[model samples]
Target: MKKMTAMVMALVMAAGMTACGNVNETSSNVGAKIENTAEVQTTDEQTEETQNSEGAEMSGIDGGWIIPDEIDMDKNPEARAAIEKTFVKMMDAEYEPVALLGKQVVAGTNYCILCKVTSLYNHTRQNYAVVYVYEDLEGKAEITDTMDITLGNTENGYAETGAENIEGGWSISDEIALDKHPEASAALEKARETLVGAEYEPVALLGTQAVAGTNYCLLCKVTAVWVEQPTYVLVYVYEDLEGNAEITYTTDFTLGDADEEYSETGEEKMEMPNPWVEYSTAEEAGREAGLAFNVPEKLGEKSIYLIQAFDGLAEVRYGTEDNEISYRKGREVDDISGDHNDYNENSAMEIDDMTIYLRGNDGKVFGAVWNDDEYSYSYYAANGVSMETAQADITALINENK
Candidate 1:
């Protein structure tokens, strides 16, 4: 009986040990599976992060110019550094960035950035905008081009009120036949009349800008041969609501002249004097002058109130009574030379290969001597006008004859 009891106890102990070993094995397998799953998840996260980083690097640009919200300074370190270097080089000094006009990815890896910058140097403040182009090589940025974008106002060569309306609108091809556009042709004719009280052959329509209203600013080049050098007059036409355009401005920089300012509102309204004499036509005046004077029936936007022509001289009075132009072709007068000698050396300027004496005393005065061998051409302008304005006006008269 004692032997049987001991054997039963031993069998029970063996069964318990087997059960414990099986449980331990199952736990170890489960822990190993969990560890493998965690490793795979961590690897997948790392791969995704690397792909995102590479995508950002390949992205061409990470910032914008005009809208501030588009600029990402943190992620786009390369572009920011490139733009700063370009601005420093172009500006030639440390300049404060004002605002970005815009930016674009021109080609595959080429980018263009437009921004306004201000420079304070020598107590003068200058503000302007510039466009910079960058070429990307691998992951580096290289500057390609830098362009200045600034328009001139009345103080320069362009009109003050209407310049902004026409900028970048349409640049008329120099090759475009002027005769094809009647409106342009008419505008040229109108410009000639308003400019010099005559009609001139239109050389080319440089460009045209249509204003928000019915008005248009026509930039036309007229045929002119004042000096030995080929002379070209830039005529700015301010078209009115009635579709009639007049020369409100003129610029001829080659002659050392600034732009001429005309009526900003439109054509001038003038009343004739009590005793006014009108020629039937300008051709009649030309016939009277012996030399053909290419005079228009009207001077400026208004019709000529008086036309006086004599031997070797012609005068067309238009607009106000004080406003008039006199053309004389004859021997140089002795008194005129004495009057010219009165001007100091500092008051002399050359225009159309002719030396002109300027006077600032009693209104602005300009006197010039032109000799065509067969005839001597002399011109004079008074009443507070700039030297350049006088040159342009007189050059127009000389061009008509040539």
Candidate 2:
């Protein structure tokens, strides 16, 4: 569960002064020439001179940062192509070319372009960055600089934004609408399902890392089960390229006075998010998966049941603490149960006109699979329950739904 991506882009970027050639910060003291890059905004007051120019001309003043009269980067092919080609290998952020902010004629052409930054995993938050691309005479493009735009005060003093504060190459996202991003929200819901012993009320999305897919850092308020004592923790959720998302780790994060609570839906007794549509109670899971399965009374009231249904398959689990019995059923003629753990012994029996194949070590039947006239059914008991006991469990499982 502790899967963290290994990346070096942030490291190279941090050592930008020495990592590569031409990024020597020797082009022309940009920080000194511009005086203050943070105050440069492409507003109506600043773009007045270029408003009358042709082809979206640069507003560069005497080899310094230019407040362009017009941006419209879609109309600038070179800038767009440079950004696409240069950032093609970058997995940290998704950059969309916004406008050509300015240009400086140096040893090579330095094009300053404005871009909207978004996480590949979540696209609900709005972030902006200014990217500097250095194009040589040979037409090879490389990123010389990048600055995350903060509306008020700049954090890194007009230098590259993603390098300094990076921990494991995880770049912090700007302020977002906490509970809005669909993917992050879905990820939190799934992670919440794994938090069986505590109450984790979500606070905000802290940051993210782009790897094979994405990893999200979420701030949550965790109340230890039965203690009523609440504290803060940073929850990390990893989502793979194939859409399999899970909580990777949870570490204590002290927020001090910065922690906040997201808006509540005012729902009572809601242990799961979107209960009917996902892992939920028996009825909801059955309706969603389109399979009407039953929970046997034999499992007892103390049993903890988790149900989930989807296209072609419906699955349920009955368990208490460490002992679990998983049930799966579907109309498709395949092993809907994903477990393939080999059992040393195997036997067969006839139950309700269907053949049940029981498998276990030396005869303690821990697994059973069968096919009724209409559907394939499977169950796994990892608790070392006996054949007779499993038969009774299976009988109760079939008898109630019929």
Candidate 3:
């Protein structure tokens, strides 16, 4: 559940950041000369400017802070001095500037600078420093606030947060109308069938955005069965560039009363026989009923009963206090086509060339029905027990009998 909660938060944050316009913009600091040795390709306009501009200013700021070429030292002397003074104070406390991530002018005289820095004493961890520079009453630029934030503790580090605060590239956009993205509708239907074992119409695309780091991300809302209530659930779908999509996360929130409680349909329930008679083995019970029986070793503390018998078929039941498994076999019941619809096609398993089907609702082993030219056999286990254990036991029974 903690993992589920974290997944929900991630989806929400992904969508939320898109709505807030935090995608990174390449043009924010157009004239800034980045000292980073990492080669980054810029657009044609940037390339033209780089060729025309002369060598940038290389002096003035102490504490080894690299002054961005965009920060015109001659034009904004006051602002340059203020940032240098602040950087020096930071260095005195052992924090050294490592990289100038970005810089942008917010208003008439206010500017924001984002940087990556490291503690000189503790070189292991990295931190983000946001410096806000504003013009004072006398029109002299001064440092207003410097907030240093630690990074890399959470699953999504500065990448997620940076995407949440920056503006422009590959971020979540507005809520995509269902008509605009027709493929999202089909994806929602598939998600409902897989998660709730029922069909549901999606309400809308809650949000759509291409992740800054990942290829694609989408969040949508659909009505689904949560507990016994019909609720709105957020489904997060992720896709690679190749268009392979997977439902990666879901968050449930109650909506209102449902028309009816969700339940598995089509299964016919039978009453327990009044006079329960015990049988030692399948052979003994089948012999009395004039039929052939193949039974495996009794599992757990089970009691075998000759539950019922008719003209061409018989039912033998093995049960513990809370779990029960039934085996029905006969020559005339060779055509089990009528009961085939109740099985989940997606949950098929092949053992010894026999195909077994599970219940669609809860993934429990519904039963296995097969004919061997002479006779037919069907095995089913009650719901609420471990399907894995039941399948294993059923497989053993079938292997031993066949």
Candidate 4:
């Protein structure tokens, strides 16, 4: 009986050992499965992360300029009339600024206006007339202050005294004007009347087309006189040293229900061809925010510098009296020199060490470049399309560095 009992005890011990071994194997298998799953999940997450990073990089892009829709004066009537009568006159005439320092008035009944000259250019064409209109205690209108803008021409070959008590020559953005008065179109009708019948010099300046073949070039100055519609006032063409005129006469000469006959000019009028349109890729332009220039308040002595950069090219011209250049770029190539004998001479441009110089009849440093290289002539003129691309490029580079 004792022997049988000892044998039973040994069998029970063997069974317990077998059960312990099975439990150990199961635990090992579970650990291995868990590690494999974790490794697979980690790898998948890393791949997804890389893909997301690449996608974000691809999405990075710069957007160029976009025209606003509300600025369309043809669709807005009230805005149009106000712009025609008031803004146009303001733009053409000189303005002055008034200081409003240390002035105080009652609550809702006082304001201040002043002209601040941040820079020369900002002081000239960008002049402003600050108006301080307020309400009185009884809600009556109060004219607290008014500022007139001063006009200054900071360019080469033209020097006009900047408007005094006014700097920042009056200027208005199309967007701001459109917002204030939506129905207005350019007040050129008065301008048109001024040109109905008058002797215009260099017919080219009277009405020129844009290089892009889309816009009419109206000389910035007036050179004729005619009757205005509705107002019946005689309008005179005002001269604008900054603008060029280039438009054709589109008229209706027929009478109602009958043919109308009028005397024709014995001399035949030659029709001018449209301006050229030019385009460029972003890679071609080198600067940021286009090119930068400093136009002085006076003209006479001038210095122009053209830079060919990795991003774009630009021309910077400076007039005497100030360190700034009268900034200009090529918009169109004008072979016609406006009866200027100097223009009759064929001029060319050459690049040296990344800098450009103008070569006139007498090959001298008419212009300079920032860098030097073998002479490769690339012609550029004010308002030329190629210069426009360079300006755009320089502008872009500026913004990037900024």
Best by lDDT: 2
Badly placed stretches (over 4 Å) of model 4 are: 1-125, 128-172, 175-352, 362-365, 368-402
lDDT on C-alpha atoms for all candidate structures? 0.37, 0.52, 0.40, 0.24
Judge candidate 4 at residue 214 and give its lDDT: 18
Compared with the true structure, the alpha-carbon lDDT of candidate 2 equals 0.52
lDDT of 4 by residue, 336-357 (tens): 1111223323332322213333
Residue 277 displacement (Å), model 1: 9.0
lDDT order of candidates, top first: 2, 3, 1, 4
The local lDDT score (0 to 100) that residue 79 gets in candidate 4 is: 29
How are the candidates ranked when ordered by TM-score, highest leading? 2, 3, 1, 4
Candidate 4 Cα RMSD after full superposition onto the native fold (Å): 35.3
Every model's TM-score: 0.25, 0.33, 0.27, 0.16
Candidate 2: regions farther than 4 A off? 1-278, 297-302
Question: Per-residue lDDT for 1-402 in model 1, tens only?
Answer: 112223234334434544454211110010011110100000001123323432112111223112223333333454566666442433222333332323444322333333333221111223232333343444444443333323222334344332244544544333334565677777656644523311244543445566642223332222222111221234455565566655444432111110112101011111111212246655666566555656444323535665655443444544556755444443323212112234432365565665554455544654555565555555544343556666666666666666
RMSD (Cα, Å) for all candidates, in order, is 34.8, 23.9, 29.2, 35.3
Error (Å) of candidate 3 at residue 388 is 2.4
Tell how far residue 285 is off in model 3, in angstroms. Answer: 2.7
Q: What's the TM for model 2?
A: 0.33
Backbone clashes under 3 angstroms, per model:
1, 0, 3, 83
